[model samples]
Target: MGAGRRPSGRCLHTGGIVMKVSYREALKMALREALSNDPRVFLMGEDVGRYGGCYAVSKGLIDEFGEERIRDTPLSESGFVGAGIGAALGGMRPIVEVMTVNFSLLCLDQIVNTAATLRHMSGGQFSVPLVVRMTTGAGRQLAAQHSHSLENYYAHVPGIRVVAPATLEDARGMLATALENPDPVIMFEHNALYNMEGELDETAGAVDIDRAAIRRSGEQVSLITFGGNLQKTLAAAEQLSTEGISAEVVDLRTLRPLDDDTIMASVRKTHRAVIISEEWRSGSLAAEVGMRIAEQAFYDLDAPLARVCSAE
Candidate 1:
């Protein structure tokens, strides 16, 4: 149940406790586990109850946790998000699920101004132990409005911690970690990754939400990305390997408190870097990564920094 080590066991064939599940299932499992472990943890969102979530991630949770814990709110994003903040402030840990990042704009004031800033403004008198989960990115062709990868917008703000769980382990582990955090945490899940299936260690529980992780190791180039762009970047890295290129892939799991050390170390080893983001080129997280590399790892670069981002 520790965050640092993956659980080991005997498989059915070999007697190990490994289970294969979709990314969506892993996320549901995490939520189910959080609710079962903490009575204060309740899930609130549109279509999260009888509708079983916008993406069906909470299909059977309502029956197990009951209606009080699995709350179904109206279409008012601002109202519910603010209520979640208030609930967190009052001693309840609320997991607010905004259907999409596009809709989160309706509650920017509640999230950035209230949930994020209360502790600092109150001189540490209050903290928002809240978790907001939403789908982000542009793979479903849901048109311009529904497909924005705007986790960067939240990441740019102060007082809030932003995390993107791009892999199965992270999807299963990070929510539990975020629930334990004293501050508000916004978790952005890529729209296209929900159905992605992979083997998950059944014992995977919590994970540290403070650092970045190197998903793939290499020495020729560093491909740094987070959230929706992680899988695409890893795929591109694999393609490059066929051409004899050694590309390293770094997943910036925690976005707000960017892990500068992990990123700088990757740049030092590779000497070249390419930052990618699902967001547009302007004011994107990839831009921040590029600038940080320029500022701290400038001497380590063997070539000019490259960026792969959406073209506006």
Candidate 2:
């Protein structure tokens, strides 16, 4: 695996070891690799440096990389986020961490206005190679303010790419790919998945952030979802299997650029579909995905499209 606390200078890949770790640990590994591999990469956000990250994902990074690389800023999302975008403009790869999706709204202008549109607005002469990461979805006792799945809000924007990493491998590796992209990328890490444990191959590295993955294969209904809801959907699929219903589970890793190909393909095979989202049903990513299936794979369905989504 990653041998030391600070595996310095171009050590992003690993091999030949299977280790069990929590989602939180996997993310730390990814951060370690990114900061170590690239001189241009640095992290800045509230509580990320001295406080060891809001969720403890960046716990040991400050000690490993120092405050300069693991910067801790004041509680102004818009200000610090704007600073990150400026760093990107100056040819520095910056990772801005907003504590939660609810707080990310405070920096909407910086993300949607500056970082997102810079490349196009500059007639392709410049690019904001920035990555903004924030925890999304609800956790116990956090209430409505700190707990919201606002993937659709960012997904609606055209210039930036949005990705929600569900599995352990994605949690560990997607950061690498997002950092590599020239345009701004928003990574929504589900609040509930931080402590979830699973086996991750040591060789895991940057994964494709552009496509959907089929978690399970079945001939009946297709259960499509992303982020924290994925585990619940997989459990639901297992229950359905017991009732003799073969449900195929589709993990929509990249939400914004919805993988219509994998989604439609699953619907075509299963001949039925159900989309699950933690976000409210109105204007949710589920609604967008369902509409696409209706337009492209409507004829192949054996039953009406269904959705299990948030009510509020």
Candidate 3:
């Protein structure tokens, strides 16, 4: 019988301890840093100002930066998103929050059609250096509409970068990297991770938004996942370890440029894989990852790939 699973503890390096922050606080700090460091950077979203923020991640920002920088808009997602694109084109770095992934669909045209295609359509003459942040994943039982995982939709789009921060370090560093990029970037912050607490390793700053991270090392199987499912997948890995199955946990931090090297390396090493995701199995990010593994590491795999996904 499988033993009870002990949750995997967060990694906190204390060699040169600076400070620790909750996931939300880390995000706030990142936002503050971006706003302070760059006069061009501004945060705009629904209730992001007076109301603190949809998730309070932008809390206290308005006080420091004022309403001009921490602007709040109406319920119109498309209108605001389009405005963000225009703002970015006007030489401003805008961080637009869409409340949640469910609402982001209202601005699909702006995100997919305009923000993504501008640089290419203009033959590199125009660049949309914009960053869009939104909450994703379920767990709070916000019902059908509010609770859904739609990261795969954004990852599927071309000319835009998609990233998910599953740890404190990423939460603190990803935004800075996104702000510097010339292309549009979509950042998905798992709704359930807002309250997560961990120490930010001060040694690491401005992490690359183009690589996958190996959360845990193992030999028997590879457990690949991202966003909200990371902690749960790590816990599951610990459970498998008790049964003599050494499972490696790989966090696909950046979904768009899916780090083939890191993913293939793990798959080739473990020889077996299990992809975990909160999205439905059909056409999910997990499915794409599995396909990539099969295409590149088929000969390295000793067993068929597996996926643990949401129920249909």
Per-prediction backbone clash count:
6, 0, 0
Candidate 3 lDDT, tens digit per residue, 190-298? 9899999766654546889999999999999999999999999999999999999899999999999899999999998999999999999999999999999999999
Candidate 1 TM-score versus the reference: 0.95
Residues 1-312, model 1: lDDT tens digits:
222222233255354567767888888889888998899999999999988898888888888888999999999999999999999999999999999999999999999889989999999999999999999988676888888888789998888899999999999999999998999999999989998887887778899899999999998999999987788888999999999999999999999899999999999999999998888899988889999999999999999999988889
* Model 3 alpha-carbon miss at residue 126, Å: 0.3
The residue-by-residue lDDT of candidate 2 on 185-297, one tens digit each, is: 99999989998987788778999999999999999999999999999999999999899999999999998788999999999998999999999999999999999999999
The CA lDDT at 170 in model 2 is 97
Q: For candidate 1, what is the lDDT?
A: 0.90
Error of 3 at 90 (Å): 0.4
Best by lDDT: 2
The global C-alpha lDDT for each of the candidates, from Candidate 1 onward, is: 0.90, 0.91, 0.90
Error of 3 at 223 (Å): 0.5
Error of 2 at 187 (Å): 0.4
In candidate 2 the C-alpha lDDT for residue 107 amounts to 96
Report how far residue 269 has shifted in candidate 1, in Å.
Answer: 0.6
Sort every candidate by TM-score, greatest first: 2, 1, 3
